[model samples]
Target chain A: MALREDQILRYSRQILLREVGGRGQQKLLDAPVTVDGASDVLDVAAAYLAASGTPLFDRTTHGGFLAGTSLESFAPDAVAVTPAKGWLGSFATAPTIDVSLFRLAVSNGGLIGVPGGMPWPGELEGQGSSDSVTLGALAALVVQRFVLGLESSLVKVRNVDGRWQRE
Target chain B: MPHAVIDITSQVCPMTWVRVKLKLESLDTGDTLEVLLKGDEPLRNLPRNAADDGHVVKSLDTLGDGTSKLVLEVRHG
Candidate 1:
């Protein structure tokens, strides 16, 4: 797909990335990335992707997510994510990531994947200020990176005794 | 020997180079580009940036009324 002049301006910063050049940007634009789960992580992820030239397919109203005049969808590139109440069910049909910040005290806090019965992700319980935003943003970054064909792994950020753990 | 042309005389500082860089990205290997701008920062920095990115700066010439023209040959490895 030929990039328009405005698109060049809109996505120039990312396009400058060696990992995410015009070709990669085009892939992002063409890709239909769906973050079905409604979490702060997906919220921030949607914003960054849309700002970077990818558009939400749902055209989810601003403030419904972005919450300011800063939300503008120009040159929308067919990328969107909506709040999924039952996100686990969608995994069977779509490529989706299950993301949530959890409390350690919650019993049986298991992460379920598509078709169910997958190895449950561990529960993250921590003390002090829970930085859900940071965790969510990191998850979003991983999702977007993976969608853009960048190297990504099944990394988890768990909170333990007020400290964050990466595995 | 295909070439592309863009005029960024009205654009400001970093954005000028940003536009030029994007324009260059849009070009194919061995393609040439002509950039038109009218600012000291852009004129001073564009050629340096082009060279820094390994593109060949064919020529840099100032025009009457303060506009400048630069020729860049795209070379990607």
Candidate 2:
């Protein structure tokens, strides 16, 4: 379906991007994404996905995060419906290294392993809010790229001595 | 080879250009698109941005009332 006037205006900024024109915006609105996992991470990702107009599959876990908030308050086009086939992913934190991870395995079995050494229990405990936000943002970005069919590669970030190291 | 017209009078600076760009993307190479808009920012910026994207600005005219019409030719490279 062609974008409605409200949608055109609502996503004007995103449509302005060369990488995400009107067609991409339409794809996002039509996309049905399933986001499930820890509430902290799920809430942030769901908010962005909603704002982008990506429809979310109605799952009990999703409702757990959106119970109090109205999705329409921020996303005029956000809709949650019966479970549908679409992009799917989850988020989890690596307690040993104090890092949040997001991965989607494609046709070929993707790599699976933590690159850094393990830490003793309670050493990397107490993951902060910032970590959850970062993980959620990354998850949303990956979903958008997948919906738009954009070329993207694996990204890894590890917390090394309280500092982030990219590999 | 083809000609199209789109009115973006209600749209602002960036969206004005965005709508025009999308129209251009839908047309074939050498196709002409006429955009109707109302704003100084878009009047000044759209033509340049369209040019930067390899499209040709065929003409731009002010229609007396407050609207301006811009004509562009798609040039994909």
What TM-score does chain B get in every candidate?
0.93, 0.93
Question: lDDT tens digits, residues A13-120, model 1?
Answer: 777665576777776665444434454445555566566654333223411223322234421332332223233334345443333332121222322111122222
lDDT of 2: 0.64
Calculate DockQ per candidate and list them: 0.21, 0.58
i-RMSD of all predictions: 2.5, 1.4
Can you tell me which runs of candidate 2 are displaced by over 4 Å? A58-73, A80-129, B61-67
Residue-by-residue lDDT tens digits, candidate 2, A70-116: 45566644654212232334322200111124533111232222223
Candidate 1 colliding pairs: A41-A136, A63-A67, A104-A125
- Under the 3 Å rule for N, CA and C atoms, how many clashes does model 2 have? 0
User: What is the DockQ score of candidate 1, to 2 decimals?
Assistant: 0.21
Who wins the DockQ comparison?
2
For candidate 1, give the lDDT. Answer: 0.57
Highest-lDDT candidate: 2
**B1-77 per-residue lDDT for model 1 (tens digits):** 33999999999877787777777878888899999999788889899988987899998898979999999999775
RMSD value for candidate 1: 8.8
Query: Which pairs, if any, clash in model 2?
Result: none
